[model samples]
Target: MNLGCIVGLKEWIVPQDKAFFDLFEQMADTVNEGAVFLNVIINNYVDVQNQCHKMKQIEHQGDLIAHQVYEQLNRTFITPLEPEEISRLATALDDILDYIDGTTQQMYGYGVTETDDFMKELARLILLSTQEVQTAVRLIRKLDDPRAVEQHCIEINRLENLADVVLGNAIKSLFATNDAITIIKLKDIYENLEVATDKCEDVANVLSDIAIRHS
Candidate 1:
């Protein structure tokens, strides 16, 4: 085989598009929606119980998409991607929304009356990361520009790093306060938001690996 043949190769074989790739896109879409809804809560900071309940509904939507991916995987013998890749991607995407919903749950359960700057910034990062993840997922479908997918993955990693820094500073600020109970509540919220970004990075890693393998 010549260099041109290898260089001109497409992104993926995609043996079963509907069974895997389409479902992956659906999962990514739901995750991004959940992140956006979380940002809504972060910005508005009103109707604690109501916002939490609404976020839970969005998370449930994500759950249904994830279940479709898993069920399709079990039924399909030949998949667009590797079986493990299909399963890993589905779970990773689901995890992001799970954390988003979980953080809102904590806010309501902890009786958080308001939001803080740190939490807002972290939620913003989570939103950015999830958007990147969705982009990468879509790119994988056609692999039109594998380089573009890699670039988006790089951005996701950068956002996750920023989330880490935000979490660190938020924790430091919390400790400065004398109210240990308040400190604990806010710290947990910050950590959950941070983890959502972490899951975004995980999705990025998987996308990068898939890109490289088929590049």
Candidate 2:
């Protein structure tokens, strides 16, 4: 709170801004990679366990980045963005990876060795959503163009709606089939994919909030 302490704190935070944004971009990249892996696994229907392992690694990487973000938040007396916004964005980004990891694990646990069109479509939608997320997060560093940032958020919302429709039709088809256990297994996977988009929407919401505040 004293002058000298304040000056030292400001100096410390100067370097952290770049570091924070760098980590955020890296985290977004990793999440998008996970989504790509998920789509590949679903479309090919081979080596799923190994692919799930890869996604787990990415999820671990996201955790490490999130931890660093929080550690920096705690140590710095000043931040490039609001401390709460930083925390929210970090948490939201982490959740997207977490859901991706969850979907991969469920595929293995449910013995879903075959790929279906619905699953593939959902996976593709997830990939698209994450791509938008990455773009929007990077644009945060260039928020002078608020319209540009909001466009990405709008795309994310549209993708989320598309994912919802995919989920609905998937569940509807599953119920029409008489294989009860298969229905149960696929229902879980479908819901997880949907939840992943929901998390992506969560990221979009946080990004929108940040843009509004900082615009």
Candidate 3:
């Protein structure tokens, strides 16, 4: 193997990594749509089962795209990113939808018919965090711009903090109510919302890791 041929081959292999970034951006967009659907289901008092079914479709699509990324990673001889980092990024993005799906399933199962102020607030935070995740993933291709990527991660962390406070206050009030079953149900829903925000933060953390290593 001549030196020039080796360098050219490596250059050709690097472009293949672009597919990962495209798929990641697509997944983030789907997550954003799922967040929007959740908010509508909670706020509007719509047909809960129907909304949940739609959300499931979105989740399934995200799963397919995630698997495609994994398959591509397996087949490629050389990747622009470390295999472990690519795997972590894919899993973190997939987990966001999992949390969203879990939230809707619980809502329908618990027979939640209306939305309270706390649920509305949590929904807002989830949407915002997903937006940040989308931006961060898109910017990740240009790791030299660490400042831009770090800003998104910082915002995600801030949103997660706000969600924690909302969950705490909501739980405190629920404890004061006399209906034990209702209390249990609301607690489960609130906790799931908080967990979804945490998952978004996880995605941000993964982006920060990639940025730091590449920059």
Candidate 4:
């Protein structure tokens, strides 16, 4: 079925729009799995690329529904929560897919043939951040618990910070390797991976804002 139909059915079937949030959580998990697989084996690049692309499509559908829900909530003057909260959540979820798509495109464009320890670590961090995102979504779906959301946001931010340090050291080491061509390609790939982590932090920031406002 089409996205609108699925979302409409979800709104009709589930009480309080819980199923909508659950679908977003599943999308995050799918993206996380794709990130982890990308890091594990270089030969699996095509598979991960396809998977990430599919996940992006799903995420886009979710974003559309979120926008619709937000608009409906605004017009109705009565919703489960504030309009800003829904908008923030929708935008943050969309950002996650954008980052994932960017990472996959970079891998293919760079012709990455092998994985390194630093890249592996970055992927791990991305997975951790996505997991935190899933947690935040789950909490928001249920109690709208500000404290729980804040805790997960903090964890995501911390993980993103660690990714920055790891990326910096990796760049330094790459420069010292004395291979100009390799350094150029590796640097681009590393930077894109780091960018993905940064996007995750952006999502966390939005979630933190939602928590503050709702608290």
Best of the candidates, TM-score: 2
For model 2 the TM-score comes to 0.94
Worst 10 residues of 2 by lDDT: 9-18
Give the per-residue lDDT of model 1 (tens digit) for 132-183: 8988999998776889999999999999999999999999989998999998
**Model 4 stretches astray by more than 4 angstroms:** 1-20, 40-77
Instruction: Tell me how far the alpha carbon of residue 110 in candidate 4 is from the true structure, in angstroms, after superposition.
Output: 1.8
List the RMSD of every prediction in angstroms: 7.2, 2.5, 3.1, 6.2
Looking at model 1, the pairs that clash are: none
Per-prediction TM-score = 0.91, 0.94, 0.93, 0.74
Question: Which segments of model 2 are wrong by more than 4 Å?
Answer: 1-10, 13-15
Candidate 3 CA-lDDT value? 0.90
Angstrom error at residue 6, model 1:
34
Instruction: Please write out the lDDT profile of model 4 over residues 1-215, one tens digit for every residue.
Output: 99999987766534455444655566556556555555553434456556556655655665565566555555543445565666666666666666666666666666766678888888788878888887786776655479989899899889989999999999999988988988988898788778877877877887787677667
What global local distance difference test value does model 2 have? 0.90
Of 1 and 2, the candidate ranking higher by lDDT: 2
Error of 1 at 90 (Å): 0.2
List where candidate 3 sits over 4 angstroms from the true fold.
1-15
Query: 3 or 4, which is superior by TM-score?
Result: 3
User: Which of candidates 1 and 3 is the stronger one according to lDDT?
Assistant: 3
